[model samples]
Target: MLNLNGQTHRRLAEAMQQAMLIPEGDELVFVIGRGNESSNLEALETWVKESLDVLEDDLALAVLPLLLNRLGQTINHWSPV
Candidate 1:
């Protein structure tokens, strides 16, 4: 897992809340495949970008790279079931 500071954690929480991607008081659970043709990352990027407003420009910029990097690592290590 990526080690995030408190402020970064809060910012991500706020972004997810604003995006309404996760229902209030609930958690998000999903899976992505390790296949080279998988479009999950692209879809996630588009979704996050579309969901953000002008006020979230910095949040998007800050979180996206970290998010993508973590996802890439996860994908790299994923073993097919």
Candidate 2:
């Protein structure tokens, strides 16, 4: 994992929130293969968690697997930080 400062983390959170606005089943290409140890992954996870706060209780759990699957592809290909 990358060691991000607070500013980097905040930027990532913002980017992720934006990513979540994409339609379901439509790949968030910008986020999908951006690599696991970068700002993008930090943003992706932050946005997902924050967005889940505004959704119906169970929707996040349902969507998380799909999110993780796409993210996993990138993680599998990542080099350690």
* lDDT value for model 2: 0.56
* Per-prediction TM-score: 0.30, 0.27
Say which candidate scores most in TM-score.
1
lDDT of 2 by residue, 1-81 (tens): 234456765666566556666333324435543443344545355554445455545776787899999899889789586
In order, candidate lDDTs are 0.50, 0.56
- Ten-residue region with minimum lDDT total, candidate 2: 22-31
